[model samples]
Target: MTSPYNNKENITDKSSDVVWHNATVTSEQRAEQKKQKPVVLWFTGLSGSGKSTVANAVEAKLMALGKHSYLLDGDNVRHGLNKDLGFSDADRIENIRRIGEVAKLFVDSGSIVLTAFISPFISDRQQVRDLLEHDQFLEVFIDTPLEVCESRDPKGLYKKARSGEIKNFTGISSDYEAPLNPEIHVKTAEFSIEQCAEQIVDALIERKYFSF
Candidate 1:
């Protein structure tokens, strides 16, 4: 399928005669009803960088505060929605492109969507950011050293990648372009998971994304 969004990775030509649909209610109205802003917390990092762990914890914190939120994890999404894709550069671009569209939908529904994806390429992540409003996308870099991520290897994929069993594996065979200036940068190697999560959640509150 072709991407409707203006992106460089459009594999197929845009379809003809597909009209855009306007929602009856505005995004501001939806977010006002939820008492928070519709935002996408895009978490980018290397494998085993604690992206999922930190995102899950932040989601829990949002729940406790009664905020509407959802998390789209990389592995979880690959299990189904993007099952057909691979780790090739082209496929990876397509992966984030599809995710950006999905996250835009969640934002329109007035929910804070947290996405956990290695998303190694800078352009791919920037494409996702372009899909949202100017202030709606917050890039959170889960900064962890290569050695630290490999050592933590929650999944054995890292070990396999090191052994030449897997190709195009981020941080092992593939390159991970770290964020130059992310909205929030958390060094997972230096902080506990709880501390990292709190730092993110607190940043949201301080930015007035949500208030008591």
Candidate 2:
């Protein structure tokens, strides 16, 4: 069959050389055999919106429930995989791109992965969501207002941004698009960390991401 495009010469079939492996013996298969579904919980919001806090706490809760999980925080990922990237719009997109691939790998490994990133741009966040299967991706918005985030300013980023020391800071120098239809919205402004974490966990439970 030919593609419906004019670039017929560009089409190449490499399907014959593909090899099959019985990775069915891996932990992913084992978990799925146990009827456990791996999920990517993406936390997006402004700085100091308690994204990292809630993600870490959620991971702890999942751990306590005897489930596999991991957390990918913005700062932590930057310290390693994305160390060379700056805060420019291009770098920000690339940063999220790398995280999206990593998160996909984690999901394939049968582990619930939580990502904590400002992910200010709606397009960038949508790109990440597009990498996963339906019901496998959960977008959680840490809906904390800018005023609250600035006041908390746990990392002093707000001060740097305000003083013109930092460039492309979300909610300070850059823009943050609120999620329109997130699977979970934790109003961090009105809730404690524990409460927020519990809310997220409950959503996961309701979604049946795990057996227990």
Candidate 3:
């Protein structure tokens, strides 16, 4: 089997002996049946930046609109699927990589997936984008300032990270490369959760994800 990333030899998972499988029903068929365009809404930001909060709100809105959707929250994922991953840079990259593959699977099944993760690295986020079609992935940047996030610190993570209790925290010990030009940018500091979520839903509706 040819590697998905044939050009990037170092990261390609090759298995010449294994056969590539195709589903009997195609993704387009599934999407048509659901009357929606499946896509991944990737929410990236620093801790306490309302990634999860806004994503949850968006998912709720999608639900109310009768669209099929799923949310993959970072902390919840680490508790199960990514339990073995640590706080190292390599682990962080692997975490996003795995999540990207999972999001692709959801998209294939005609469901909109919202992933809420710090996803601090630009390269890692780009890798996820590469896994999907042109319109299959939309980057949603929750642009909350460091001061605002630190002040909110809903999980007390910032306090711990500041006190040297947590290592490799994004926006602190680790680097958070903000999206240079994300598809959707929402500043939680300036807007309410409903407004931010509605902004995203409006974008998808304008994009014709589903006819209202």
Candidate 4:
């Protein structure tokens, strides 16, 4: 049952094992082309709290400004890389962990990464923050009040969660741990989606995370 390729006894040494090499297109080159430095905008909040809304708007704005960027929406990612994960606490943590690693890689590739997820646990959010440099990781807490999120209920999830149809729902069956000191906290209850995107862009500019 052995494969024909295994009969050759192929072996790899230390030199080949280490694939580290200088980038042909450096970060500086990317910055110059995009007119901005790349970073990971880690958006954390409860479902129906406008995390994805704001993240999408921010990415669109960045694109209009000629910046390279991409968004890692929770629902979208779950359908792909994290398809097997469920809504349990442990699954939530692992989901954030995988997304964080992927976002960090996107940042390293000289592209701004916008991640929108209901990362309810402060610890899980902090774990994602620890994956990047101070200027590279921007923790944006979409502080939408429970009442506001419930009222919005864009996806009807809040109603299902409250009716006991859904389990481990953040801000409902599950607890949401607010960030102690996030880089940017958008109180969505009081601000429009455009306002939230502007606030995030202002923070990025203030931090000098973008050259222009």
Clashes, model 3: 0
TM-score of every candidate relative to the true structure: 0.93, 0.87, 0.93, 0.86
Best by lDDT: 3
lDDT of 1 by residue, 1-212 (tens): 75445454452344444568898999889999999998999999999999999999999999999999999999999999999899999999989999999999999999999999999999999999998889899999999999999998998989999899999999888999999999999999999999999999999999999998
In terms of lDDT, model 2 sits at 0.88
Give a tens-digit lDDT track for model 2, residues 88-173: 99899989999999998888788888999999888988898899888789999999989999999998999999999998888978
Clash count for each candidate, listed in order shown: 0, 0, 0, 0
Candidate 4 has a TM-score of 0.86
lDDT tens readout by residue for model 3, 1-212: 87454345544444544687998999999998889999999999999999999999999999998999999999999999999899999999989999999999999999999999999999999999999999999999999999999999999999999999999999999999999999999999999999999999999999888877
lDDT string, candidate 4, 1-212, tens digits: 97553344443443457777887887767766766777888898888889999999998888777778999999999999999899999999989999999988788778889999988898888888788877788889999888988999988999999899999998989999988898898988888889999999888778776755
Spell out the clash pairs found in candidate 2.
Answer: none
> Once superposed on the true structure, which residue ranges of model 3 sit more than 4 Å away at CA?
1-14
- Per-residue lDDT, model 2, residue 124, is 85
- List per-prediction Cα lDDT, in the order shown: 0.94, 0.88, 0.95, 0.86
Provide the lDDT at 108 for model 1.
Answer: 95
